[model samples]
Target chain A: MLNNSITAAMADIATAVKRYSLVGMLGWQDVRQRYRRSAVGPFWLTISMGVMIGTIGLVFGQIFNSPMKEFLPFLAAGMILWSFISTCVLEGCSSLIAAESIIKQLPIPLFVHILRTIWRNTLILAHNIVIFPLVLLAVQKPLGLEALWSIPGFALLVLNLAWISLILSLLCARYRDLPQIIASVLQIAFYLTPIMWLPSLLPGRAGTYLLDLNPIYHLLQIVRAPLLGQDVSTVSWCVAGGMALFGWCIAIIIYGLYKRRIAYWL
Target chain B: MACIEFNNACVDFPIYNASARSLKKRLIQVATGGKISSNEQGRVIVRALEDLTFSLNDGDRVGLLGHNGAGKSTLLRLLSGVYAPSAGTASISGEVASLIDISLGIDPEASGRENIFMRGILLGMTKSDIAEKLEEIIEFSELGDFIDMPVRTYSSGMHLRLAFAVSTTIRPEILIMDEWLSVGDEGFKHKAEARMNELVEATSILVIASHSRDLVLHTCNRVIWLEHGKIKMDSDPETVTRAYFGH
Candidate 1:
C-alpha cells in the first residue's frame, strides 16, 4: 500500500506534465483574468515593474554609489527573477485552496494545480523580463555568448521553484496558518537575498559564504550571473541542481502520503 | 468495460480549526509527545463514508438517496474519484465526468465563449473537442450577441444557462450528477433535461445522487440509500424507493 501510493504520486505528476497544454491554457486565463479591465491589459506587468525598477534604481544607485548604467540593469534582472520565485512560492500556497470548487468536483490530479500556479507566475515573469533587456539597451551594454547559459540556468531555477512550491501547497492546505508564516518568511528573505544590493558590499569572505548558504542566493546567481555576461560559480549551479533533485524527492514522498487526504482536509 | 469498485472504503474528514492547523503547535506535539492543540488527537475526524464496499458494472444506473449529511454527496464524490478513501480502496476504471458543479472554473470576467472553453476543459474535454462543439454549445445557450460579452455582464439566468450548456456538452464513459438538470426557465429546463437524458443513455454507468424519489425510481435500475455514512438499504429501485420514501 505504501509503495502503491508512491507510484500514484509519481503517476499523477507525470500525467499533469503531459497535459502541459491544459496548464498553459489555464495559466494564460489566470493572467488575463487579473488584468481584464485595464487598457494596457497584461502589459501593465511590464510597465509597473519598469516604474518600480526606475525608482529603486535611482535611489539605491545613489546610495550604493554604483554607476546607474551598471546598477539599473543588475537590479532589474535580480528583481525580475526574485519576484518570479517569490510569487511562485507565495501564490502556490493557495494553488489548491483557490481551486477548491474544481478540486472538489473534478478528479484531476492534484499536481496540476501547482503546475498551474507555476505556469501563471512564469507568464508574469515573461512580462517583467522585458525590463531587463530594455534597461541593458538604455545603458548600451553588450552581452557575451555566456549569456546563453542563462537558458539552462533559468530552467534549473524553475525546476527548483516547482518542488518548493509543491511542498508549500500541500503543507499550507493542511495548515491554514502556513500561508501567513510563509508570507512573512518571504518578506524577510527579499531583504536578505541581495536583490537590491551587491554581494561585494557585504563585509568580507564570511559574507560570500553566508550568501552561498542561502539557496535563494545561489538560485539568483545561476541565472543572473549568466544574463549579466558573467560566469556563474559552479557552486551555484550545483546547489540549485541539488536542491531541485532532493526537494522533488521529498515533495513526492509528502504528496504520496497526504494527497488522498487533501479532499478531507479541505 | 467500465467498472466502479469499493472495498471497505472509508472517508474521514479531518476537522481542524485555525488553532489545530498551526504548524508550531503540531511541531510542539511532535517534539514533546503531548497535545498542544484542542480536540482528540488535536483533530476531529468526521467519518463521511464508512465501510462502503460495492461493485457497479455497465448498464447499472445507480441512484443514491439520503437525507442531508447522510453521505450522498460524499459517496458521489468517492464514485467520481474526487475523494480517495482514507482507509481501504476505491477505484474507478473509466472516464468520469462529474457534473457536481459545472461552473467550477468559469471566470466571470471572461467572455461567455471563453467561459465555455474554461468549463469545457475543466470537465476534461480537450481543446479540439471543445472547438468542434463550440457552435453547438453557444447555440444551445442562446446567448448569441452576448456570447462575446464578458460573463460578468450577463444576468444571473444567462450565466447559469451558459454553464449548463458547456457542462452538459461533455460526454464521458461514467457520468455523475448531483441532481436532475433544472436550470433556467421552463423552456430551457426542457432542453437541459433532454440533453441530460442523452448523456445518461450514452454512459456505460450512471450514478446520480438526488432527493427526488420519482426521478430515481424512473431513471435508475438500482438504488443505494445511505444513512449516516453507511448503507441503510441497497437493492432494486422499486424495493429501495418503496422503503426509503414510504410509498
Candidate 2:
C-alpha cells in the first residue's frame, strides 16, 4: 500500500542518517574543496552575489524605470534566493555521481548523500546571507530580530530541496545522462521561475497563474517574502507545504523500490 | 567471540542485458525471444546464494576455498552485512571488522592523512582510537612524507600500504576477509602476513575466502570448500584441502 511504502521510506531515512555521518562531512568537503586553494574561499559566493545584485539593479532599474533605491534591495533579495534555489537543484542532480565511491564501498543510507548535497549548499547560502545584512546596514534600512523568521523560512526551503535531491539523485543514478538533462532544464527554469525579474512585470493574465502554480516560485516567495519584510501569503504556505509532502512521498517510494538495486547499478 | 549464522540465506540478483538498461528493450527482447526460441523471459535472475545455512562459533578460524565465480565473495558480503539476503537471515552477535576489500572505501582524491581517517572510520574506529594508533599506522605503512600527499598522487604500493595499515590496526571480534591478504609488495607482504597472524591469534573467529591452499592450511584450522554455491566439503584444513585439490 502507499501508506506502507511511506512508513518504510521514513524508517530507511532514519537508518541512513544514523549510519552515515561521513556523508555530511563529504558534502561539507565538496563545498570546502570547491573554494580551497583560492585566495578568497567561499567569499567568492558573496562576491558573486554583490556583482550580480549591483549589475542587475543598475541596468534593470533604468530599463524598468524603477527607483534605484527600491530596485537595488529588490534585486539583491531576488539574487540571493535565486542562488539558493539554483544551487540546491543543480548540485542535487550530481549528488549521487559525486558520492559513487562511497555508495559502492559502504551501504550507508542513500538519502544521507542527498542531505549532504543540500547541507553543503546551505553552507554556501550562509555566506550569501552575509551580503544581505551588510547591504541593509549600509542603506540604513531597518533590520531587527524579526529577520530571524527567515531561518524557519530557509529551513522549509531546505526540507523541500532535500526531497528533490533524493528523487533526482536516484533518477540520475539509474540513467547516466539524466544529470546533464536536469542541468539544461534548470537553465530554462531560471528564466521561467521569476528569478531575474519580478513576475509582476510580466505581460500578463495567464503568466501570473503559471507563476502561482509553480511550487518553486512559491518556495522562493515564502523565504524571500519573509527576508524582504513583505507579507507572507497563505497561498504560498499551502503550496510549499503541499509540495514538501508530495516530494517526500515520491522520493521515498522511488528510494524504497530502488534502494536494493543501487549497489548493483553502481 | 560470538556466534555467526546465515540461516536459509538467499540472494537474488536481477540480471539485465549488457547492451541497454530500459524497460522497452527488455520487453522487446522478451517478446522476440518467445517467438524465436525457448525460455521466453529473456531476462535472467541469478540466485547467488540458495538456502545456504551455516554457523561458526568462537575461535573457529575457517577458510573458504572455492573456484572463481563460486559465490565466495557473495558469502563474505552476506557475513559483513553489505548485501542483505533476500530470503533469510544473516545474524552476528559481536562487532565484525570486514577486510572484504582492503582498499574498498579509500577516497582517491584525499590525502594519505585524510584516507587514514576515512578508512579508520569505515573500519569502525573511533576518533580517539585512530588518534592513538595514528603514529603506529603511519610508521608501519612507511609512507612517511607521502602521508600528507593526496592518495591520487600515491603509487599503488603506497595506496596498499595505507589500506593495509588502517584495516589491520582495528582488532575486531570477528574478521572477514576476501582475498585481501595479497595487497602490497614482497616486503610489505611479509609485514602484512605477520599482522594477519596477530589478528588471527587475537580474534575469536576469522572467515577468509581464498583460493590459496597454503593460506588455508597456515591461517585456518578448518576449511570449507564451496562449489556452485554449496558447501562440498567442510572439515580439517588437511582433509578439505586434499579433497578440494583431489591430490
Candidate 3:
C-alpha cells in the first residue's frame, strides 16, 4: 500500500515535470500579467531589489565596518538568492490553494501548480539577478571560473527549495494557519540566514557550528560563495545536497499520503 | 476502448471552518441538506456521494439529473477524476476533459489568440496541438480582427464565443460537461451549437449534468437520477425523465 502510494505520487511529479510547456507558459503569464500596465513592467522587480540592496548594503556596511567593495557584492548575491528562495516558499504555500478554480473544475496533477509558483519566482529571480553582476563589476572582482559554479549551485538551491515548498504547500492547504505561520518563520529566517551580515562576523563557535546547523546558511553559502568568488566549503555542498535528498523523501511520503486529499482540502 | 468501472465508490466532503480555511463562504456552495454531520474527530462531513456502483463504456451518453444539492456536479467531478472517491475506486480509461468552466485558464489581459493557447493547455492539449489548431480556433470564433486584441476588450458575446471555440476545439476520449453549452448571440449560437455537437459526437463517452428535462431526453441514451448523493433511479432516459419531471 505504501509503495503504491509513493509510486502514484512519483507519477504525479513526473507528469507535472513533463508538462513544462504548460508550467512555463503559465508562469511566464503570471509574471507578465502582474506587471502588464506598469511602464517599466518586471523591471520594477529589478529596481526595487536594487534599491533595497543598496540601502541595506550601505547601512550594514557602515555598521559592520566592512569595506563597500566586498560588502555590496556579498549583499547582492545574498539578497537576490534570498528573494527567489522566500518568494518560492511563500507562494508555494498557496500554490495549490490559489489554484482552487482549476483544482475543482478540471483534473490536473497538483504539483503543476507548485511548479508554476517556482517557475514564476525563478523568472523574477532572473530579473533580480541583473544586480549581482553590476555589484561585482563595481567591486572590481575579476570574473573567475568559480563564478560559473553558481550555475550548479543555483540548480541545487532550487531543488532544495522545491522539496521544502512542496511539503509546505500540502501543509498549508490542510492547515489554514500554516501559511501565516510559515511567513512569520521565513521573516525570522531572513534575518538569521546571514544575508545582511557576514557569516564570519559571528566569531568562533557561532560561525563554526551555528552557521553549519542552519541548512539555509549552507544553501546560501554554496551559491552565494560561488557568485561572490569565494570558496564554498565542501561541508556546505554536502549539507545542501543531503538536505535535498532527505527533504524530498519526507515530501514524497507526505505527498503520497495527502496528495489526493488536496482537492478536498481546498 | 474507453471504459470506466466504479465499485461502491463513495465521496465524503469534510466541511472545515477557520482552522483550514477562512470564514469566507465556500465557493462551491451547492444546495445540500441533512447529510452535514460530524465524524469522530468532530469535523463536519457532508456525504456528497455514497456507495455508487456503475460502469460506463464507449458510446455511452449518460445524463445526470438532480436538484441543486443532489450531487450531480460532484458525480461529474468524480467521473472526471478531479475528486478521488473517499472509498472504493473508479478506474477510468482514456483521456477525460471536464468542461466545468470552459474559460478556466483564459487571461483577460492576454490577447484572444494567446488565451486560446492558455485554455488549450489547461484542457491538456500539447503546445503543438494548440498551435496547429490556433487558426481554426480563431476562425471558428469569427473574431478575426479582435483575435489579436486582449479578451477584456471583447464584448460579452464575443468573450463567450472565444471561450466556447477554444474549449470545444479539442475532442477528448471522454467528455464531461456541467450543462449543454450554448453561447453567443442568436446567430453565432447556431454555429456554436453545431461545433459543440460535433465535438460531443466525436467523443467515445460523455457524461453531462443538467436540470433540463428536454435536453437530457433528446441527447442522452441513459439517465441517472440522484437525490441527496444517492442514486434514486437509473434507467432509459424516457423512463427516468418521465418519473423525474412527473410527466
Ordered list by lDDT, greatest first: 3, 1, 2
Task: List candidate 2 stretches off by more than 4 Å.
Answer: A1-11, A35-59, A130-142, B1-3, B17-20, B23-47, B86-94, B104-111, B142-146, B149-156, B180-191
Worst 10 residues of 2 chain A by lDDT: A101-110
DockQ of each: 0.80, 0.28, 0.54
Write the residue-wise lDDT of candidate 2 on A152-189 in tens digits: 77778888988888888777666666777778887887
Better of 2 and 3 by lDDT: 3
- Candidate 3 per-residue lDDT, tens place, A131-233, comes to 9888877878777888889889989998998898899889888777778878999999998888999877888877765597888899988898977778989
Q: Per-residue CA lDDT of candidate 1, range B110-174, in tens? A: 89988888888777788899999999999999999999999999898999999999988877899
**Superposition error at B140 for model 3 (Å):** 0.8
Q: Measured by C-alpha RMSD in angstroms, how accurate is candidate 3?
A: 4.5
Q: Model 3, range B101-143, lDDT digits (tens) per residue?
A: 8878889999998998899998889989998989988888999
TM-score of each: 0.96, 0.83, 0.96
Q: Identify the runs in model 3 with alpha carbons over 4 angstroms from their true place.
A: B19-39
The per-candidate count of clashes, in order, stands at 0, 0, 0
Q: Between candidates 1 and 2, which one is better according to DockQ?
A: 1
